[model samples]
Target: MTNASTGQMTPATSGVLLVLAHPALERSRANRALAKAAKGLSGVTFKDLYEIYPDFVIDIESEQAALSAHDVVALQFPLYWYSTPALMKEWLDLVWLHGFAYGEGGEALKGKKLFVACTTGAGAKAYHAHGYNRFSMDEFLRPLEQTAHLCGMVWEAPFVVHGAAVKDDAALKAEAERYRARVASLLPAKTEA
Candidate 1:
């Protein structure tokens, strides 16, 4: 795929694991559009956490294996209650183990890239100190950044679709395209041997 911003053809080497965490995907237009945007990209692996682990039973080994195979890990979700959905939290707790994600021997995720692509119900103006939400989106995402730090991963800027609930169809489509481009950009260039 060609990157929209740089106009460069992204090689297949740019492996991205997009972990989606929307609890009720059927009910969300924004997330569904975003997910559709990511579908069938060359080196992008899409995993819906809620669908894969409906009972909250995460396969630690599988999750770890998936992480190990990707250069970029993107968490896609809706900002629920100012944080990730409960299943995402649970997945992190179970998969990011002491010896795998952090601690003495946890070097598996070192140098990997971590990012979040999320939707927010509130508008951009509502996410400031003076706004009703009372905090910037960046502020609300600090914990995820810190998690990347602790795991020795590179924290990339998050892709946020603000005011999702009220965006018109055109706006939603544009946002989804932007998201697809962002995900495509995360892929590293292919080096010739």
Candidate 2:
């Protein structure tokens, strides 16, 4: 892939796949910025679920192939009702089949890594036991962690942005950079050869 700003070519095979899920991306400032940052990075393959499957009809073989081609899979989205967007859930249900993800001959994701990068409208304090949400982010994210465990994949600590709807421009930009850096860190290191 080519670096948008540097005007230079980067490695096309980064072994990193970032799947983004947002029902209405244009309406989201934080998600849009993060998506741009992720797409600009080198050594990463970015796929927008909503954009690709607007009709909610996913191509199973293509999705599976993309997953099989990458070592690290990053799921990016805005937290909706304390869970992923509807399309993301659908994608999970359809693409992550029993035989392909967690049964006999379902070792495609084994030993790989799964990471979540999400933005929440509420502040971090809202996710506490005594807070409005009455649960921690980790608690809300348990399902995904368990999914990784079930698939024999390593679960990395998530990258979260609280108060997604209210961040100032500077804060938003910083979050985007932070996200890009975090995703880039997951890319396989280049060899000296």
Candidate closest to the true structure, highest TM-score: 2
CA-lDDT, candidates in order? 0.91, 0.91
lDDT of 1 by residue, 162-191 (tens): 989899999999999999999888977665
lDDT at 56, model 1: 99
| Candidate 1: clashing pairs of residues | none
**CA shift of 144, model 2, Å:** 0.7
Q: What local lDDT does model 2 show for residue 23? A: 92
> lDDT tens string, model 2, 1-193?
5677798886444467999999999999999999899878766889999999999999999998888878899999999999999999999999998989998989888888999999999999999999999999999999999999999999999999999999999999999999889988898887643
The parts of candidate 2 lying over 4 Å away from their true place are 1-14
Per model, how many backbone clashes are there?
0, 0
